[model samples]
Target: MKIAFVGKGGSGKTTLSSLFIRHLAASRVPVMAVDADINQHLGVALGLDEAEAAALPAMGAHLPLIKNYLRGDNPRIASAETMIKTTPPGEGSRLLHVTGDNPVYDACARPVLLEGETVRLMATGPFTESDLGVACYHSKVGAVELCLNHLVDGREEYVVVDMTAGSDSFASGMFTRFDMTFLVAEPTRKGVAVYRQYKEYARDFGVPLRVVGNKVQNPDDLAFLRAEVGEDLLVAVGHSDWVRAMEKGRTTRFASLEAPNREALTLLHAAADASYEQRDWERYTRQMVHFHLKNAESWANAKTGADLAAQVDPAFVLAEGAAAPQPA
Candidate 1:
């Protein structure tokens, strides 16, 4: 399952994401945690000390290498510059499966030792001073989308991403890459407002947008969420002293998790068994190419649709046995 946790800033999305990954790892399940946020704090949430987390490499720093590795035996992708995010994966392209050998995974994955077991954690990139004026985070997250486009998960394996806050996800196609997206919403008006925005946008893409209500202190808080999101509200989490204590540096161990949060995670795990819909590669590639071409016209000299189509792998076809039509 490719799960993304997104919400308004301060809505506890990262905490929930880290907790879910820990839960899965503790259960002896194979899990990969991705810190896709520009803030990049999922490492601390996952119990990594600052020094340890800082030691891990940023995936975006190696994008050129990763793209080259994923190109594999594909003759069309002779170099990193030729393979854009919309480049469809052919038999020659690297295949990143849950438990098997994949050059893409090898290039980016870093071991995060936790609870006597090692979980693989990969980060997209950190916000840098050099990007203060020009770089969009969308470009950084595009690396994650490229990785997911090649990933193949098994029944018991999971990929959880801690996404950037709020509607910033709309800056790119990364939001559509998830099998399930947990919108961690608070009971405030702004929090529920973000939920409405995501629900409306996701409807067109068939993305499963579920709400996980955070910091519910009473019946009224839960009721407020129920009123706003209706059936989309999957679970309501109560205030957790344990988490609060950890936040204050009393301890680093996650000993007593809130019950409601645990129940929600259990449900999330069960849902993963049947939640994923196998995407049509050719269709997805075409949509991504269209998105890129639209951006290219405004940002670069690549003015024609044909210019974008040339970046795609011709041999990568749809699951329904058809190739994406090249633009004229």
Candidate 2:
């Protein structure tokens, strides 16, 4: 299953995402975590020391190799340079499995020790000095989009993404890529405002979004969240001294976490597990193709000097155990 954590900046999405990934890893579940946020703080949140986190390779730094590898021998793609981030995998393209051995994972994914278990993580990387004026942060996120585009994860396995905050993800079809998106909102007006925006935009696209209220200190905060989000409210996580200590560089064990916060994590995990059973590969493929065609018509065709729509394999369907499409 593919899950995303998103919300207003500083709404604790990254922290919640890290906690969820750790929870899954500690349970011995096969999982991969991708920090697709521009802030690039997931490694630190997942218990990596500053130096260790800095040493991890950035996926954005290897776009060419990733694009080339995923393109495989697909005749329609022409060359790796012609493939945009929105490029949908089709005939002869490489497909990825969660927890499977692949060159992409070998190069970009790193292991982070959480308790006695290990979690694989990848980051979209931070903007370098060279990118000061030339690049947008979304360009860096393209690598993550491509990875999710080709990935075929199983129900038992998981890929959790820490998405860029707010409605910035709606700038691209990337918002539609997840099986479930947990929108972490504090009990503030600005917090629920972002939720309204996401709900409005995602309504037509069938994005399964749930609201996870953060920093609820009293009955008022909880009531505010329930009134604003209604049935979309999944769970509310209270303040955590354990998280605060971890943030301050004072080490603490997960077992020492407050029971309520711990239960909230379990609820989030259970919600995500329920989504895994509802995976719809055909709809997933259609979404990929829809975005690919939209990009092709809008800019990719002129940019690549090819009719990029031809890249779509009409007969191709993405499903567990489905065969990769053959080149026409």
Candidate 3:
């Protein structure tokens, strides 16, 4: 399944995404986890060392061959089709792999800069400055197109995109491209407030919304939110020491069951799929209130009998009180 993850920064959404990838990979699925967020921390969170995490640069590093072709350069050497790396499943884990380009070096080298090519092209090893900021980062639409092509054309059944934080235009664009969208929110009022705001806006656009409240300490807090946010589409995964899972280079179900470093991803997988089957609570949203109020208004108007029942009360009014009962 191609699932997308989105939420505010520091929401542990990326970490959660990592675990799902790991979980799928452990089951022997050829998983390709894309760090759509420019920060590119998935490798670190997955316990890959520098040498191990090094392939990401290639995935985002290359300037598209179309740019080279447009520039009238040789097409044969400019394409990154073969060099982009992918991670493979291993013994109860996953093995790492990359194809041709090394973005860490490619990004640093000056290039015939495409108007948007910003990873700062270079031809070298490490980067002292990694996230030049996504604005400064460049993605050749060709590369993204290639990735999508593979997903549709080949054997990879899963492609998980860990998106950037917030509700920017790019986030909206990314949201549109996916088959399923998962919004990660926290239990705090601020989190719920932001979540609702996005939901209302997205609903206007007809975005099918599913919510996951991460790092929850009290399930009751979810109850409170249900009163306001409509709990039918909401699910909660309790606050575990998620960072501790990252710090220890392991998972508390962060990515796999073998090591669950206080991460709630395991519950996330199940909760995400089972929300419809498991949750059954009355809605407390303003929409429901308004619906019932409108219903009551209709009921009151019906009782008035301005149109129906010939201006009659069930037992009293008879079309302007015509012919009252005489003494029997």
Best candidate according to lDDT: 2
Report the number of the highest-TM-score candidate: 2
Q: Candidate 1 has which clashing residue pairs, if any?
A: none
RMSD of 1: 4.6
Q: What does candidate 1's lDDT look like per residue over 209-230, in tens digits?
A: 8899999999999999999999
The backbone clash count of each candidate, in order, is: 0, 0, 20
Report lDDT (Cα) of residue 126, candidate 3. Answer: 26
Winner on TM-score between 2 and 3 is 2
- TM-scores of the candidates are 0.87, 0.96, 0.54
For model 1 the local lDDT of residue 166 reads 93
lDDT values, one for every candidate: 0.75, 0.88, 0.44
Across 1-328, the per-residue lDDT of candidate 3 in tens digits comes to 4457777777777877766666655555444456666456766665555565565454334534322211222122222222221111111111112122332223422221111222121111223365445433323222332233222211234556676665641322334334446777776677677667767666643344567777767768777656656753446666455556656765344233434332445554554444333312122112222322343345423643332212111221111112221111
